[model samples]
Target: MLIDFRPSGRLRGKNPVDFDSAVGPVLNALAAGRRDVSRMRVACDWVQYRENFRDIVDVRPVLPRPDSAESQAGQAAGAPGYDVELAVDVRRSGTVALGDLTAARLAGDDLDGRVYLEDWGLAGQSCIWDFNALYWSALELWEKASGRGYEQALPGGESDARNRGAARELISGLFTVWDRLAAAGALPEELYVAELGVGNGSQAKIFLDEFRDLDQTGERGYYRRLHYLMCDYSQYVLDLARETVVAHAGHVSSVALDATRPSHSLGFLRGKTFLLYISNVYDNLPTDEVAQLGGRPYSVQTRAYFPPGAATELAASVSAEPEELPGLVRRLLRLGPALLADSAPEHIGDTDTAVRFWQEAWSALRLEERYVPLAGLDLYSLAPGVSGEELRPLLESGADVRMHVSSGAVASFVDSLPLLHPFGRLVCHDLFVTKVQDYRVGFRGPGKYDGSVVNWVNGPLLAHAGRRRGFDVRFEPFRHRSGGNIMTMTTQPGD
Candidate 1:
């Protein structure tokens, strides 16, 4: 029998999965049930983080098709038995839970049909994003109820974009580029720079403030001709950002637009923008995870669910039935907190109560994941113009692996690329997994950041997509901060 165990480093000093205690009993049960136990393979994936799913021991029967690599290998070795995939979360399951899961599996309780709610499609299309959108849409209420701003939840309680030194360096680089253009008499009358996901506007304030000061000192006059557009999906964030950059009102404009489809709202600026800046945005965008296992590709499907106990508690909090929770959640996602309050006043008395419900629901929510085979890469769409073929090289780069597609990021990148001037560039700083090996080392998120979802943007995949579009894409460690996961990605016209 083949036993594959993937252990997490987080549980150092502590046994993440004890072979004797956890695997021995399961193997014994399997042997007792089946005569051909020697032909079976058991693969275990253990994670230390709490995912959106609540399953302690998720066991799925892996039946490789006749055409699959696994089956072919088994046929060659004269081993025809099937495989079993076991996924465990140490954060939620203990030794007793593992034993119970083993007994349950022996009793033919695969736990595949058991779910708290309906499947939400692929991970990217999950209703979690709807909750994310509602979070941004009702920022004020969330912040008031949480007693802290979203920015406060970041690693350093702020973004590195606000670093004055980084802003100064970027301003210097822009001035040098603009000076050369000015000398050639190629500079446009109105210089343009846009910042996407302008969180709280502090980054814009730093950039604009530095640009104005440097331009005046250098006598470049670029500041006066500059047009700074602050674009974000949330009007609430835009409003807050507008207030933060009020000093540069003459040169700054707030645009309430979706970051994933910037071209839809800023199409007029195509090929006119000198610089497009993004920070901590791509990671927050929706993404789908794909896994290459047994030489076959599979899409990760997810379903948002509330644990039975939590669901019961949540229902009681809102004075409703557990069956009604899904409808309420759907309603909350469809309508923002304030609207939900007005729409379901009988359940949620006011906006404050609605916000409380949102928080409680968010806390209780979990995602159940399963792997579904893909027909072909061409049939998959990463974004509108981007294809799943872009993920081919990365997925097949090494042994079996799983990585995010960053569908939303790719869409935003593709849409924003056309906005750049011939001599312009796009720069983004966020949590980027630059190497495919990195995904194997640790969890790359789908983790929560305050009220939003975050997954590490697949930097190599983005680079691949950029190169295909006649652009040079590169990533460097964020120069502003010494210790952090943030990486700087710059894209410009390729030679």
Candidate 2:
């Protein structure tokens, strides 16, 4: 048997995992059972985030032989395979979790009452995104109630795009390209530049402000011909951004569109945009995660849930029963807080009360995870045109590993690529896991950032996709920030 332990920093001083209390009890229970358990591998991990949910003890087969009796019985029983590999979550008290595991194992219970919500398919397709959309759509209410903006929750309390140095560098590069195009008499009549996820428009303001100032001194004449587009999913954020760049109103336009399918909305700008800028947006988009264990690929399926106790408490707080909580949460995700309040005035008295409920629900929300086998890589689609074949080298490159497909990021990247001019470049600053090994060492995320999901983009897979499309993709640390997770990804037409 192989045992692996990956504990968080907080667990360093104390015993991270108690083998006698946790592992020994489960092993003893299995030993007493009819099933063979001699070949099992055990892994224990401490999930640092309170927002994440993991089973106390999870068991699965690691590459079961096809002709083995265990495999046949697993098929007959509708089980994935023999539970040969066990994963334990050390977040809960070891003895208590082991007792629960042993009790369920011995009694043959399905562990039903622990689940507050039913399975919702894969993590990416779950209703979490619905809540995420509602959060952004009704961001004004969230910010008002929290007494702070979403940007304040970021590592530096602001986006790196707002850094004057970074903005100046990007603007300078654009000016150089525009200058060359103009000298060659190939510049378009209307110079176009687009910024996606224009949070508060501060980044746009800085870029535009610098562009105008630099143009005045250099006499590039590009600022006069410039058309800046501030694009975002939230009209409220767009409105705030518009006010921030009101000085350059004539030169700017606010576009309310989905970032994942920019081409669907900005098809007119195909090959017209001279530069596309994105900041801290891709990570928030929906993504599915996949993992490889013993050369077998599995998709990480998840169901968003509230713990039983939290569910009862939340329901009681809203004057509802625990059984009625899912429907109410569904209603909250479907409708913004205001509409939910308007729709269910008895339960949620006002918009403020609704917002509070939303906050509490978000705080209590967790994800239960399981692994389902992938049929094939070629059969999987990362985006509309991009294939799961791109994930092949990454997954098989090393030992057992798990990583995000960054489905939304890839779709956005592929769709937005068509909008770039021949000399255009796409610049994005966000959380990126540049190496596959990173996923093996620690959790990348599905962590909550205020009200939205945040996952590290699969940078290497993205680079592969870009290269397949004849674009050169590269990643580097965010130059302006020291000791940050943010990486700068630049995609441009290859030579």
Candidate 3:
């Protein structure tokens, strides 16, 4: 058995111990008496911090495909043939154990620590977020006043200050454009503004309030002709948003629609809508990360999340088997089961139990990542027939590229473009990374925010995609300050 260990990136400074020296003895202990241990490699992708490397462990399994010529050639050359991947994380100290594999705890500091098994990977995988249907399904439970969710989840909550600034900007830009279009007789009889992911509708209220003031003073009559649509996937959020925007009921309409596929429900608004607004929504959408390893492009494969101890009880209550979470989540979403009916006692049936379990499990969940080759990869579909290749230029960059595919964001942006009136514009504020190198330093997450997943959008890629579609795309710092992390992206029809 031959094992290869490669360090990723250059060493910035002195470390507690060198990568090879720190991990060599631990691997020896794991490999001892294991006949199946053949050729193995460890590509260190993170730097040691405080004598510990807290980073994702990437495990790629090279398996022979029955129909592939490459597999046949490899077999002829006496190459190993298996589709299993073993994840190894070397900590400063601890006994290593994972499903079917175990390593003895070493006594000395000859090598700094032990190699712990992080995950066992199969060859093929899908987007993990696609399967994470439970969190959104159970959203209503955590969106209440007592529930632990976003600041905008509850009714009567104040809108983010940045939202106020965004509203002011929208008013300024839209009013000027409206005047020009009205003068040219190009303006639609009825003006439209769509807000996707309208949490509690506070932002809508602020914008409406500002618009009304401007209309009464300016005598533009734009507000009289305005139609404000609040759209969200969750019916509960839509209801809450509607309540917050009740003052503008005459001009407002609420719809339960998937933001990623807005056209499905909003087709009637094609080329009529004046503005499409989104706030802190793109980061919550499902995304996939791809990397370029040694000049070869590979997709990052995700297994299920590992729950912390605090959430152990909740996780166990919600899912009997962690691997089957997607199916379980779908079932629970359809039928709110207080307990795993088949596994739990009959007395344990209450909806609150299910809701609590869902919230806790989400708070504790942390995704695991591995690398799979790009050949025959299950790239996430953007639109029904759209392929992920639209993002190839970004991921194919020479450096070890790891960036969010933002498939949903791309699809939403692409689909929303056609819905805009001639003078219409799309305005969105989100965590957007403008450079591929930003990922090389550290990719901005799949982080958990209460019950939601927050990932940074690949801004440069989205900008590139917009340009190809003949739209003028621009990115600037968020007008309202909560954090500099948020960037405002605007797209308008090309001249």
| Number of the top-ranking candidate, with lDDT as the measure | 2
Q: Any runs in candidate 2 off by more than 4 Å, and if so which?
A: 6-41, 44-50, 53-112, 118-120
For all candidates in order, the CA lDDT equals 0.81, 0.81, 0.62
Residue pairs clashing, model 3: none
Write model 3 residue lDDT over 1-495, tens digit each, in one string: 333332333333564335554455446655573535544433333332222112233344543344578756766776544443333443332233321232421222211312112243421223235323445555655555235556643222333433666688789899998999889998878899998889877888999999999889999999999999998887777888888888899999988887778988899999888889998778777776766554445566655544334334543565444444444444554555444444343322556655655554444444445566666433645444456666677766655455677777777888888898877888887889978777765436665555556678989878888888899999988767644567889999889
Model 2 CA lDDT for position 438: 75
TM-score between candidate 1 and the true structure: 0.89
Residue-level lDDT tens digits of model 1 in 1-495? 656554545436654445566466566666666645554445554553353444555654444554677557756876444355555444444546466676575465643433265664888888888888988988899999999999998888988888999889888878888999999999999999999999899999999888888888988788889999999999889999999999999999888898899999899899999889999999999999998776678788878887667888899998998888888888888887888878887799998888899998887787766677777899999999888988999988876677999999999999899999998999999999999987766667687777888888999999999999999999999987898888999999888
Ranking by TM-score: 1, 2, 3
Q: Give the range where candidate 3 is weakest over 10 consecutive residues by summed lDDT.
A: 108-117
**Backbone clashes, candidate 1:** 3
lDDT of 2 by residue, 1-495 (tens): 555554534344665445466557666766666555545556666654455445466554444454577457656764333235566666663537585575464454644544355574767898788878988999999999999999998887988889999988998898888778888998888989999999999999999999999899998777889999999999999999999999999999989999899988788899998889999999999999888765567777778787677787888898988778888888888787888888888899988899999999988876666677787899988889888999999999877777999999999999999899999999999999998877776667777888887888999989999999999999999999899889999999999
Point out where model 1 deviates above 4 Å.
Answer: 1-56, 60-84, 90-115
Clashing pairs in 2: none
User: TM-scores across all candidates?
Assistant: 0.89, 0.87, 0.74
Clashes by residue pair, model 1: 52-366, 52-367, 53-367
